[model samples]
Target: MVRCVVQSQWLIYSKHLPSISTAKRHSIQAFPLFAISGRGSSSHTLSADDNAKPLLMGPLDNVMPRHHITPKALFIPASSSSKEKILKILKSGLAQTIKAIPTVAGHVKAASNPIQEGSMCVTTPFGAVEDIFTAQDLTESHPEMDYDDLKRRHFPMEAVDSNVVYSLPDLMKAEKPVFLAQANFIRGGLVLGISLHHSFGDGTSLKTILQTWATCCRGESAAPTLTESTRRERLMSSETGASLDEFPEYATIPDNIAGYQPGVAKGEGPEIAPEPPQVDSHVFYLSAQRLKGLKDLASAKLEGSDWISTSDALSALLWRSITVARNLEPGDAATEDTRVLNIPLDGRRIMREDTNSYMGNMILFNNATTPLRNLLSSPPQLPEIARTIRQSISRIDEKYIKRAISAIGSVPDVSKVIMSGGTFGESALTISSWGNLHMDWGHVIGGPSERVRVSKIPFPGVCVILPASEPGNRSTEPNGVEVMIGLKSDDMARLMNDPFFASFAEWRCS
Candidate 1:
């Protein structure tokens, strides 16, 4: 039984307010992940790795990974001015987007290990933008926008299941970096959140680059780019690299699963669950002030000695949301003992320096556990629930990812009739990127909507947040963080209707 005492700081805020300013800043966009072969199969394999534990144990061999082309480009124009702009953006790490094939092709070519996994970011020799500016002008005119308030804006709060394509200026023969990010507005101003490929980089690196780019745009001091060796390459290792035969011990699916039916085996790919006929979708933008308020209130609820993060608070709320919805279902599988929260961990920190930053669909690892179960029952133990969240985050490692990848790829991939060249699919629930956005390209440079697909990401059951727009970054009074509780339509309805779930959520921000 976990006991949580509500601190005065967290107890004072209301749940909803008219303006984003009064509420916690939580503007989140949604994206979903879809396997190339979309269908749900029954045979499961849980991952046994420090970072990933959801993938079940199985004979995983001969799996060719998939790669999506970046919709944007990074090209320096041939003109001297354009070249200068490119240099400026690189020096400061912020350049106007120029979506083209040649530049990104060049980056793809630069990869030392282009076959399986590799990534590279470089300035094209030359590229032209609209008559207003050249790539070079962008480089020299200002530094990247490196402000905390600014950089954090360009990342999507939720990394879900769907494909994405960001904008790049359509320069004839000229190009710039094409990312999966878009530009938007904040408090009547422009912002950017480039939630690119999940394989390219981890959240920390992505966020750092966003800030660095903002600083570059603002003409601030430049941030040094990581060395090429460290910047990319090293994500792929031959099956022999780590003896792909070693599977984790705790990699088997349990006897019973929640929110799912029994024994329909397809394999380790996404099951094609029918989306709601009319899913209610909306994008909410958060202001900096509202976010801070939620954080403050959440902090107030904790002991002075305890430290928790906004992400932590939100995770608790969402987890509770799921439980609440499940409890309402008149199902045999709805047992309090069989729930788990799967967290995606970017194992970059755990790898060697050379591979740490290397990009290219490196791999998948998870950190998941049954969160504080006591909270959803009769009288919620809020503090204990918060502590459990704090503790669950403590156990994450890189070997888990490597091992999981090895195991995923190790499966013989048995198909009665094999396709010439294609991988399989598995139905899953994924959670990535919490509270991130991009306003620079969409709003900063100010381009047409066709220039980018603002909400192309489509991952079901995802939890996303607008970083700086949340309560911690902006708020003065007690309040809960403004977060988009994304779930399949059915899941959403159950969540809002249940009291324990909503109460669990309200307490998380405190």
Candidate 2:
């Protein structure tokens, strides 16, 4: 039997909040159904003011815009100190933090020369891009949503530029660092908004910077080891060796995909990705006990060298449960053989480099598919599902990473390659796991600091599995995983109620 719990309570709004003048104020949109989890007499804001000139960006930073200036927020539950004290620490830390991560303090500019044959080539010479730092205070602008409400809210809907699918051309032309941060105080906690362009850095890069900032807030002496120079040196080095096999033939274009002719006008994209379907975002917690049970189930079904992992079990369960929720089975002609999962696998380990060494976008999308009919009719074949996902990721070995580098080098505009790489829709699910990122370094704010309870990308239509570590067991035994899923309003409504899914995860839906 499955147990399902639902909560639908509306929260009150605070018309005004106290002021923290160190940070610039920016209006933030209000959200529905929120509550204040802790007690705070007043609210305030603080901005990071760094006046350094914008720095020129490398070719590696110009390829994909999918991650351009993203709004990523972390919920910091109220601490023992007053909100003002905490804000002051964050403000002071920002100054030091921005100085350390120079790239985030600059902006991206395009090539000045309009025409050159190899100009579009990533390895070819290009013009310089500018950069700078900016900050905002969103405390007064947005409606006060409870920490739990924020957790259940569809992150993409609340995120800035949630509709963007690929390439932030506007940000590039402006020659500004594809980064911004907004700080807001809720009733019982604080939401630290960190935004960075994909061109500036990847998830790993962001995590390093945030953790370092946290370290600084705690008055510790920790220097950032990752730098933009590291990324440039690795990519331009001949050692990577231009290998053709690295390119996935199916994912690449036969010719110029973005239609870039060196002498011609820059091509225009499809503008903003069509507004995502009206969707509801939900958060599901997988307790350690339930996590082991699912993995055990998968392991019990496997034989010989074939085995299942914790990730595999979770992925399989989500795929099957979603399929069942949609009622897409054998007799359902419209939905048979339509389920597909896109997993973004990190390539640093496969490339034989220190996994923690370089902070840049080093990942590839691996797609796995199983017919809906097969998934629905197969008598509890989760092991098979787990195996398919495992194989998909395992295939992205050293050879694949090298080929990807070669393919990226050949492309004039990499965004084209990224867009054409996979599918995204109701029938499709793209899951990116940051569980291993180890963001537990956020315990640097005050005396006896609390580690970041919830860290999320808040993008719509996609699922991001972030770290959920207990106070002390982070290094050894992680508490569990927090899965943030976005689906169309009707689809999400049904999915959260699906009995099979409810059996494993604890869900809170709005």
Candidate 3:
């Protein structure tokens, strides 16, 4: 007998159970409700005063898109664990996580006046847990395919449809939950999709939440403490009196640019081109051996005392390879065409105060520009290109970050400020690394996730560095790194065939 419990009500149903009422069974079938036990139960019911108070939003949060964070899919293979048990565990764990970070349960409230321009807050209401979580039984409708089959197919978009993930319209609604999740159970596995509001936090915060939830699911007492000192104002205080001139990453754009919309935030979605190109997505895996060789080759070119990181070498390779694939004429290199690499730098450790655990946006974009001739030189300048990239990263110190924040605060309207380093387009590339995040869910599901994937890429000329499947194993180094890239169809074809690129990056998809 399968006993499903919701709050104080118990609804029991199974293939062999015939004594249950038709109406009660129908209700269970319509909505498969699960109860959240532990601390979540006590805080599930909010008081009138709790609902009236609004959570604070930092300055960085305001500039972020008002939509949901990019959705991520975690694939768990089939096991003896029943669907009810998994949902119950996840629900309880999520509820406890929300109890620690209450801001996630709240909804964003847009600013109505100039004073509140970059200080929008989230308002929490009662009974929001139900709206934040959902479960769907897709065993009959969609059976799980082989893991290798799914990977070769690049994980179809339909796998993360509205049935298992929140739609953009639903997320844009002001009343929707700041954090949303759905669990789809198929014939042979489970697909878990989770999304948080961009205004609520960044990738680090999401990692903390997931880690804490997993701990709780394992029947342990684990709850993160979000203190007042960790708020955005602490790091981006306008009282510092820093000047915007010191920050060179951002510039003012004229209002006459076509398709430029006023008051709309950056990263709201993918930028729409006048004539959009045909884009294709692919994943490339670089084994540890290849990465070491690439790093050694690039390091040999560096002068004494000058060094580059693994990330730098990899980025340099991609930059050079991508430029070659663009198919620019050799004579065109004489022109002043330059390729730009936009890298997001995390400001947690650079700050004087310890904000490593702060669950808000602390990321700033740093652009590295290279002339077409230098990148297309006869012999590859991997080391020189890497040094340039390293220099751009090293320039971002605590002082520079603070000044950047102050510059942002001084603007009359943040929506008008544009990042000088282009976000999307063929000439620019944005590479974001999430390889250091903790996403192991073996404790809850009885095994590690087979694969983790971004549901969709928002634009072309973008690449994401995903974390290793077994990141927690300290005994041995990571097997390799997986890079997901989206580029023009023709450019992708050229990249795949390029001997230099094929030598390092192994294509993982069909």
Model 2: which ten-residue window has the lowest total lDDT? 3-12
**Candidate 3, residues 1-510: lDDT per residue as tens digits?**
111110000000011111222222110011111111122222233345655666555545654555556777777666677778888888887777666666666776554443433345666563445667788887776555444456456455434554444423363444445777777776567777777666667677677777777777777765444423224444544235444444444543345544666556443333332433567878788888899998987787577889999999998888888888775575567667777877877777566656666777676777788888767776788888898899999998866766566556665555444344432234666777773443455544655566667655534567777656433454676567878777888888988998888888988752
Per candidate, the number of residue pairs that clash is 143, 17, 0
Give the C-alpha miss distance for residue 465 in model 3, angstroms: 1.0
* lDDT by residue (tens digit), candidate 2, 112-162: 442211212111121121222223334455444554455445332233222
RMSD of 3: 14.6
lDDT of each: 0.32, 0.48, 0.61
For model 2, the stretches where C-alpha displacement exceeds 4 angstroms are 1-63, 66-69, 80-87, 112-173, 227-230, 236-270, 327-329, 333-338, 412-415, 421-426, 435-461, 469-478
Models 1 onward score TM values of: 0.48, 0.71, 0.81
Off by over 4 Å in 3: 1-51, 114-119, 144-172, 227-230, 238-245, 252-276, 423-425, 435-438, 442-444, 469-477
- Return the top candidate by lDDT: 3
**Candidate 2 lDDT for residue 186:** 58
Tell me the lDDT of model 2 at 48.
Answer: 35
Best by TM-score, which number?
A: 3
